[model samples]
Target chain A: MGLVAVTWMNCLGRCLPQKTRFLHTLKGRQSDQILMSPSLASLDLPDTWTPNSSCQSIPDIRKSFNEQTPTVIDGKLMATEIRSKIADQVRQMKKCLGKVPGLAVILVGQRRDSLTYVHNKIIACEEVGMKSVVTELPTDCADADVQNAVMRFNKDPSIHGILVQLPLPQHLDEEKILDALCLEKDVDGFHPLNMGNLSLRGREPLFIPCTPKACIELLIRSGVKIMGKKAVVIGRSNIVGLPTSLLLQRHHATVTIVHAFTENPEQITSEAEIVVSAAGVPSLVRGNWIKSGATVIDVGTSPVEDPSSEDGYRLVGDVCFEEVKKVASVITPVPGGVGPMTVTMLLVNTLDSAKRMLNFT
Target chain B: MGLVAVTWMNCLGRCLPQKTRFLHTLKGRQSDQILMSPSLASLDLPDTWTPNSSCQSIPDIRKSFNEQTPTVIDGKLMATEIRSKIADQVRQMKKCLGKVPGLAVILVGQRRDSLTYVHNKIIACEEVGMKSVVTELPTDCADADVQNAVMRFNKDPSIHGILVQLPLPQHLDEEKILDALCLEKDVDGFHPLNMGNLSLRGREPLFIPCTPKACIELLIRSGVKIMGKKAVVIGRSNIVGLPTSLLLQRHHATVTIVHAFTENPEQITSEAEIVVSAAGVPSLVRGNWIKSGATVIDVGTSPVEDPSSEDGYRLVGDVCFEEVKKVASVITPVPGGVGPMTVTMLLVNTLDSAKRMLNFT
Candidate 1:
């Protein structure tokens, strides 16, 4: 048929020349070149704002927009370089699958801040070499003792990850012990089908809830750039502000949230560029609810009785970190920020649920 | 103990007097009295802005904010008064349980707009007395012939809502025939555990997706006071702009969204008071992206090529409706807007999944 429409117009002119040079560099560009093209920070974007084909490039988006000072993201040095590369991939999957990753926990009572967050998640699952259990219970337990300790760690085949330790004891039911877990060892993604496949858009959420995956792994290991910016969040809680505003609209930004019946929450967090907060309600984000450069994060902690330390009480967050680290460009800090990356993203979601239950990739 | 701290300060002076008159009517008021107290229209609000104790009162929120002229929002006369009140509740559940609500539908190829949307959802389940089937298949069927027609209406006990009809032809497997339908007969809520319990917060979503439950039942049957207002939404599309921005943040507003990597989306939808749009991109929301007493709700249609009338092309939507009915004060009209309230919210989610599978309530 006329040589298949001239060979399909020369195979769509070689598969559409990089989407016609990314729509001819977004024609007559200037909305400050699509807000300095941090991949056009989105909420549900993706209509051709290519930007050196993803993952920041134009000189690292002009050195994160001409950096001047602020920065401080750290999150305990990116959770010690992501728990030292998940403890060298759990010592190379226990030297080729002799079995490594486990992580159970149930801990119904003993609230000394939930026994120091279950002893710092059993010392971060034995410093990443993995395998750690728990159970605990008492302090007037019984909702069938926390769903029989979550159905015995969901029939523990060397428990790939379970976790229960939340604010469990007010005559316990806690959504019937988090609906007796086992949505493949939930890993604390707070299963409602893993928060509905982390708020669906080509669904994919096996586990994401470690303080909103340590606030998007401290904004992608601090290179920042959450596509088309303007975030916000603050707090909606269901474990850290509604899955960190559904993981900042799956890293396409343009989020918003705000909370506590947002009357003017500092004029919607002073028109954010990325805020977060997670209002546990201490400072409740201040420094004129920032916007000067914005990055923030905070994830609110809230203890506050201090009487000059020595365990009288300390903690505090929801930003006001020295007045939002002087108009934030990037901030983090409350007691080594996002609290040691929420126990290093629960040992990286229990070594990715033991490499997807030992298939070990 | 000092007369028991004076009888616990006279029982905390009679249980904190309506939270001290809702925090003394929110101290120095003005932030336009908490955005004119439509129950502090929120995204996550709820700290205490009592507003005549909920559900619109202040003279119907000042007569829907001093109405002027625009108010269209008919949705085909609210889908014929919600399909005549779902045909008088499916004829009072077929005179108390003789059984009526069925609604199956599978429909595979002959794509004349998926056979006119499974022939208008089998003529709106036989104009609501209910029971309607339709299978169709063939366009080179097999993905186990559309997952055995969704496991024969998930083992039909006279099926209580099934539905498959979406763009299903290009080599079948639409998410494994929608994960082999039957999360309590899904009734098209596009289950990700019912969109993770409709974006969690005291979860609850057995079914919702009929065009975001007819755009939140035409803004709560037109009273239109989605708490703490600021909305926006444009498009995210997991069927109607991410479940109508998670049902307008579960009716607490403060949303945002804006898509196609929004740069200024008309300066964030002209600082929204509730926008909606759904970007099936026809006119794509203009009239300075509204906000003069906004409340838009387009839900785009997009047909275009009109050779004037029938089968030539007509549809249209995504707002331009005579330039957003001159700066919206409440608009809708795109072929009687939101397409007959998405088939009257699929016959009110097939009579609420046959009154939740005959437990009948």
Candidate 2:
């Protein structure tokens, strides 16, 4: 393992810049040097050094990475562009058919994050000229109340997409409520049938989960080639990691999934050309865990206490951003990365669902 | 790469026997050496040799490998044992509820292979004291004819399981016919809903696809640990490769799928501790593609013309078995491997379905 790691690092270091040009073109951003903590900058070690070395004798080599330029993927910029296009399409649909896409959201509880998410989704729908509806129920609401809300939305012809806010109250049966949702209006794409279709080769899902869709959209729009690449997706949650891994295979990437149970994850991860971390653990993926010239999509967002922020907390992703950016050819920043694209993709899905329903295409 | 290959060979060579002892106990078979051709025996290389070496100077090392004893996983023996248990349970069900499990198969057209598969399923059903029914249609039959047959079985109270024989005349709508199958009686587990449930983390499919289930059964029953292991599944077909990969992940193995579009599949495969090849190509996976002491499950079966056989053809697997057995810690042979286990698993699904329906434990 030691010998192989050395050979891989040397080979990748020589080929890094040439392979990263395509990804750099997607953002049109020049690589710039930034200061990082010396504690986490393991990738800055000298070529003669190995992973087996003790840190006590090693000299700091962070100064050598001053010229290391990696493209910081701009997800917020991409989301704005997509939203503008969707708004144009929604206007065109309204002019032709006198009706636009409609999204219905069901929020069962008062969790602050869930409330903010639901509010953001509603605002996003409105920004794109789509009708929005929200049904807020008490935390102690019966299972029938949630099912009733879903059934009502399912029958409404005006609604093109419907989503039940996740992490429902502990008393309610989440699976049963989700199962009651109409497959057509399941814009969240949490339905098992939609997931099954996504997993199968010839079958197509009606709607892909927004976060996974967002990750793929970011990759494609950034000019990254997916076919035949070795991709390692950390975590296997159904909503993100599992579907993203399945989606990558659909795009012809040989994908490996590294979850909590996987042994020697860094060794496996270091071999991937594409790394997507969705484990929701902050700074879990370090610099040495990444291969040079790899494109990293960080989907993990966990709240960390920050006295400087208005809310006294801020979001951090799975990748140690400062250290990883110097090593990765392309990397997405936590707050402005996959976070902004999810709601935008929901709008895309809603528009698509409406177009299909109205037979306007 | 050369340096690392030599190091890996030495390390695995020293530890192979101990790591394989648990799997060997599953069959209680003594290590017996067998003769092999000189051409494919690549693992008998000396410690100083690397993968970069030219073949001309190497002397024959076949005699040294005469002591290599790998446990041949006997799927036929396991299937027989499982079927006997199911038979005893079926008799108990008859005594308690005055009814036994029933399997209904719908066969379209007269494809010889399909006919043989259906016949074998029926015989297996009878051998376990279950009622069996077959519905055959002509090659030119209309779509509704197949649907009607499926519907009849769906409505029959005595039937606990239903399966539509695959590769139905190419003109027939295979997906639509499968979609018509009732989920409860979908013993083949080809329905999209069942597949969807299987893919979800918290959801459970009513039945798992038989072939993939058979592969897992072989691994588990043989005392092979799946958790925290690396598994490579070579193929992306919906039926075998895809599901087996999903099942392996569910068992907590970090899994990678190698399909036709994948580059350097051998490199990815050589890193795995578990390799399941379902590519259906004859000898597609060679000796050098596997790591020492890996547990190889070959689900590939393609018939090759053989004048010595009574049928004028013999079945061969994806792995070059003669070569792989020398390196693999545990291996399953072509004729008696996963083939028999598929039918047996179908029986298990049927009996479980019957028990669920009859409210029996």
Candidate 3:
């Protein structure tokens, strides 16, 4: 990790490429600035890892930031409370309307991670006393096969929320399949119209993406003031960074998004009062890279090797947790923080969809 | 104006209503902070009014900013160049295919502003040697009336673009009318699907919102470096601020939007390297509010009283032009800056829509 930090510093100091005349079709920065420095947290370091010198002494820097703000945002507790509320709502709905909410998920491939996600979604539905079904297809399934399943779910009156698991077969048209789902049943909120409505001021999306929704929920529950503060969102993926940035701006935080193409990502993050790192890169954001006393929401959940652990692999966020925890006023832990909240939001969206569809609103 | 400013400040200082928890439905900022201060330049002082004490000495401040950057972005010149290119394209299409691209606008009401806008758009089309049509309906027209006109144009091959003038009658459903237009013919980019496409990654909107496109074109043509630079957009209106902020993000500018609900907006703007003021307030931004070397693109065009002028009302932007000029590296003038570029972009969208339909590209 120390060697990587030194190498990263040397790279940042190097002179950039020559300039060119401005043109109409210019897509990116003309300067030869190197973007997307390799994340240092994923490095195979000895168990006795010493902190980088320039990034050291968090306790000394702690005095400079708001020492009063020692609150560590407890996401796991919040998720449990929300889930209880959902379960109660489900019980009341069953008693009054004689029906419970239903969710249908379409899993296209046999990827182990995707199967796990689908299984967890089913379990969440069951926890709330809701009916859930998963339509599994082989890895080599055609686009038509996925579309037919989604259409069946869309037509099923019992299924109020329809979710199509991501990373479909390479040959499948992801956009077409996602677009085919009925707008009312698109609980995952990946539909284009839903995304558009999310962006427009007066127009509201039928559903909010789970991950971004979870991040905002954590911020609000933790009493993180976003109004008029400088915010930096790493990564620009449609599912996380882009929508998260939009939500931050709507929440009145002045937002800056740093992605793979962004130069000086760390410098930008340091200026932010609120940092939401969604970039999948492990340890991309170091402790020194965060603003003192700033609220850090680590959304990245990449698995990193840990020889000392029984599993030999541990989940980590984009932030260097141990280092950032010392400086940040509040930070979300990887496994317990954003992860559980995402599942809860998905369930919440599904329930809301059911309420709207069943005229229980 | 002085009375209004004092009243606005008093309102800002008052404690806001609270106790509402941040739920999924909570859309905007909770706390309010005084964002804009009265622009000293707009004060009804003598012609020889001096600068504010804190903002005195332009030369001393000039040295603090980049000395070589004396570029004032001339939108009129750039517009002329772009129109010429469009005209050339139009002529080529006419000669090669023996057909000209046509645009159809549906105006539902007789609002004077709407009339003027439609007239200007038609004139813009004519100037580029393209065909144009306007379907003006009574103010009391039903939603079906607007829908029928849009449907007719959607089927007309000659009519490659369809635009619905906004601010329909109180009884008319604006969303219904917009959604009724064919996606391919949505030249205004207001259709939820088109907007969704614009907001989503990897999905291309049939049209880019004209004003946002113009602002980006001006930035690119003027050689403004957006990458890794902090940018502030002053407004959150769907037509301007929201889309402009999105475009700035797409251009790799670290974008922050300061809306009416924002706190300490001047301080936020002062941190920006590029400022796009789209708030339709006259002289809401002052000299001290701007960063020394920032590029200011004023999108606001509110009419302000000017007793001495030939017209009782004169147009002004959100920025206090004379004062911001001294501090900003580049500034766009109100009458010529973003206005012409907006009309040009409408034409460009129409031409692009035509080219797509005619297989010109």
Highest DockQ against the true fold, candidate: 2
What's the lDDT of the predicted structure labeled candidate 2?
0.78
**What C-alpha lDDT values do all the predictions have?**
0.71, 0.78, 0.73
Give one digit per residue, the lDDT tens place, for model 3 in B211-327.
987887787666676645678898877778877877766555667777654545676677688899988877788887787878999998877677886756667788888878888
What TM-score would candidate 1 get against the native? 0.34
Residue-pair clashes, model 3: 0
> Cα deviation of A174 in candidate 2 (Å)?
1.3
How many angstroms is residue B175 displaced in model 2 relative to the true structure, after the best TM-score fit?
0.9
Which segments of model 3 are wrong by more than 4 Å?
Answer: A1-65, A96-98, A110-112, A169-171, A307-312, B1-63, B96-98, B108-113, B137-149, B168-172, B306-312
Displacement of residue A275 (Cα, Å) in model 3 is 2.4
Candidate 2 lDDT by residue in tens digits, B1-361: 1221222223234433543423323222222201010111121221111111211322321222233778899999989988988898899899999999999999998876677789989999999999999999999998899999999999999999999998788788878888898899999888888888877776778888889888877886676777668999998778888888988877667899987656567777877889999988887888877777888999987778899988677788888898889888899999899989999989998998998899988
TM-score of each: 0.34, 0.82, 0.77
When sorted by DockQ, best at the front, the candidate numbers are 2, 1, 3
In CAPRI terms, where does candidate 1 land? incorrect
* Candidate with more favorable, higher DockQ: 1 or 3: 1
Candidate 1 local lDDT, B1-361, one digit each (tens): 1221222123223334555534433431433120111121122224432211122211212122445678888888778867877788788888998888988888887866567667877887787779888888788968998888889889989888888878677777676788779888888888788888778766667777888778766775666766567788887867778778877776666787877665566667767877888877777677766767788988877676777777777777877778667667888888887778888788787787788789876
Candidate 3 clashing pairs?
none
For each candidate, C-alpha RMSD in Å? 27.7, 13.7, 18.5
Better candidate number, 1 or 3, judged by TM-score: 3
